[model samples]
Target: MGLMALVTLGEWAAKVGRAETAVRNHLAAAPGFPAPKGTRPRTGKGTPYEEYDEAELDEFLKAWEAAHAPARYQVPGDPDEMRTLGAIAKLLGVDGKSVTQYRAAIDEHAAHEDRGARRYYRTGDVVEVLNSRKGFGVALDPTRDRRRTATASEPGS
Candidate 1:
């Protein structure tokens, strides 16, 4: 019979007032049996509890802020520019691989530009690349006066 069957039989025998030695012997002989001593049974410490003192709490907060603080390369006006690969993946409804591909496309484009001019991608380039069709899109290079005019214009309907 199976180990389960043996266990069941052993349980039944114990219930019916069978000798303790006999039930134990039957259980011990069951297939795939391990000695009772082998199991490292879990002790109930329950969930781990953490206590933070004022100094420790302050240090932890500082460390967390430093780790999560926005990098200098991020766009000045766009909060989305602060996103990491995982955050970008979540926002764009895609995985890390897609983000990698987008980065590769940007690198390739930059390489292509380097062949003709000493051009590096700005934040706008990255934005365009992310929203581009097949890694290509119309990029407008605003003149200095045009930028000033655009900035001066008030928001309206």
Candidate 2:
């Protein structure tokens, strides 16, 4: 029989630029993909090793490249301006209403609110708010936290 090489999930994941878990998931879903031959190190309990001859590895590499190739058609122009509220909303994976509410909250609490028909916010600010408020939906306002802490510590709070 021809010689077969064995590779671990870690090696495959590294070659494909994916996490080990993702490699396991893909292997599970693709029955046609090469199956694990045996445990690694060939002595004690270890992760299952997938059998790969030179031809199989080349086939896998070609398939991976084709799957990840960028789309042929590209957008006509540069994407929408980053400072626009709509663009910010898209980047943050939120709707216009959420962006508006965040802007309003910042304006109300801020020392000076910009006055214009089309108010613009820095992309950095929107990203910061989105990342900071991901779980609790509360802006990372140190002053607000201090006030709550002081109030709770008071005798009648």
Candidate 3:
């Protein structure tokens, strides 16, 4: 009679492994059936399913990690030091133009601070840009530098 009723039928068909085309046809033919709220039925543009095995998924994850491993170097402590597009470009081993594009991607609220002077990027943010990944990476805090340096300098002192 309504969208919820249609969605319930779709969910049941999905659980029973019915062909997506059949489910769509059924939904389309039903009178008073509203479109599902959050999901859109596939429009037959691309492959519907890849059907990867568990080992394939695991291998995909491993390849992703290997491709995104961070360079073995500590980032500079000052956020401002790393703020400039040129500086970020050098740090990430990319062109200045790429850095300019990255500046565009920065969250707008974070971008507008100190009259646009204090541009700070967490370590994780740099990693995300460099890795071209969706998630943030670990950020370097200036306050912790002293403790890090101290531990490095003392050979069991």
Candidate 4:
């Protein structure tokens, strides 16, 4: 997992849209689940948590997501796609300030710029950064009152 992203079990739970207990329960029966690569130390005051390889998690998720057409959050066309900070913010459904605050914390951090004077980052890098945070994984717009909750009517129901 050289320089790649490692996220805690909590983040994995968020990624799968399940509670941590659900994840723990599933793990017992699902040997295919990615094993924890290691643990990441807390920045402030908290117990360190089990960290798993993010790429492995993605691979596992892709297979499960196949039947659920049009995922709640669309994966980028290219994981290596270059995007500016504003674009990353939109992708994560977060304010620019929040992303900027965590930008430096991203693993293997680097900033690229084209002649247009805009800073760009790799899509994967941004995801790594977001997964490291305590309050990320779920893209909730703070200013919105209601999230999209209605599923499509079942084929002419």
Candidate 5:
């Protein structure tokens, strides 16, 4: 069989003949959007991605992308620097909890470290998640110079 009707963000963009950024922003702004499954208790932290049922992810994506609306302006890439979950979430057009799920799924491929009470992620890792999940073609070089290499693969670069 061919790819599923609702696959990547790019697929949704293609179906609606609009940019992926637009589709995401619209979903983010839509009323009554489903929040990410699983929550961290105030006393405890770290919700492993495995806590979510696979079907939940499918349902969310299907509903979110079904509209296929175009974006008003281009969504920019994450800055080539360390980013908090909120920053990454804004870039991905999802809530911060959803980003935690994505981070859990691809934790091995990207590097992250906890500083004090908050966990900080490399922008390269966030871009990798966007590229792999959204098919947005964001790139990050496997180099020591994180800042320089990360931006080297952004849209305009």
Candidate 6:
């Protein structure tokens, strides 16, 4: 596989073009289906949030299809597609306003214009903000050069 993915039930269902219940209630109980590797507390109610390795799941599904169904799986690379700020926010589970502000403040990354000149960004850049912890509590001061050395007064200095 070209990417690392620990997918949830919804994602799994989407990958295999099956209903969530079909995957949960039927296929998951099948002998050849892959078992969930981990689980977290559900956000609302119902069953705990179970996660599966997308690569492994795809491999199993591919074989199953060859033996039983009419399809094959194509494991994708890390999601780097360009998307609007709103789309990025939706995908990354962040507030749309926060993404907009962060994007504007960064003043980098030339956006691709599509859908009558709407702006879009690479998914990796947006994901990097979340993973690198550079998007939160960022101070943008016009008076101070961002490259300046941190003073003793700054936090963690």
- Model 3 lDDT tens row, 1-157: 3323223333343343333344346433544333333433344564332222323333443454455454443454554343655566677676777556546555432333333755555544554554552321212332432322222211111
Rank all candidate structures by their lDDT, best first, as comma-separated numbers.
Answer: 4, 6, 5, 2, 3, 1
Which segments of model 1 are wrong by more than 4 Å? 1-80, 107-125, 135-157
**Cα error, candidate 2, residue 154 (Å):** 56
Candidate 4 wrongly placed segments (more than 4 Å): 42-47, 65-157
Q: For model 4, how does the per-residue alpha-carbon lDDT over 112-139 read when each residue is reduced to its tens digit?
A: 5564776677777676656544332223
- Model 5: residue 79 alpha-carbon error in angstroms: 4.4
Estimate TM-scores for all models: 0.23, 0.38, 0.32, 0.35, 0.34, 0.38
Error of 6 at 25 (Å): 3.1
**C-alpha root-mean-square deviation, each candidate:** 27.7, 15.4, 20.3, 17.0, 18.4, 17.6
Per-residue C-alpha lDDT of model 6 across residues 1-157, encoded as one tens digit per residue: 3656778766766555454555566557768788788875654665777788888788876665555531221212345677787877776555787667656443364334556767766666655544433211123442353433323321112
- Best candidate per lDDT, number? 4
Which run of 10 residues does model 1 get worst, by summed lDDT? 148-157
| Candidate 2, superposed: residue stretches over 4 Å from native | 1-3, 41-51, 68-73, 77-157
Among residues 3 or more apart in sequence or in different chains, the pairs in candidate 4 whose N, CA or C atoms overlap within 3 Å are none
Worst 10 residues of 6 by lDDT: 69-78
List clash counts for every candidate, in order: 0, 0, 3, 0, 1, 0
Q: Model 5, range 39-78, lDDT digits (tens) per residue?
A: 2232235432212233443565466555542232223464
As for lDDT, the candidate ahead, 3 or 4, is: 4
What's the alpha carbon RMSD for model 6? 17.6
Q: lDDT (CA) for every model shown? A: 0.37, 0.47, 0.41, 0.58, 0.48, 0.57
Model 3 spans > 4 angstroms off: 1-50, 68-73, 91-93, 107-132, 135-157
* Pairwise lDDT winner, candidates 1 and 3: 3
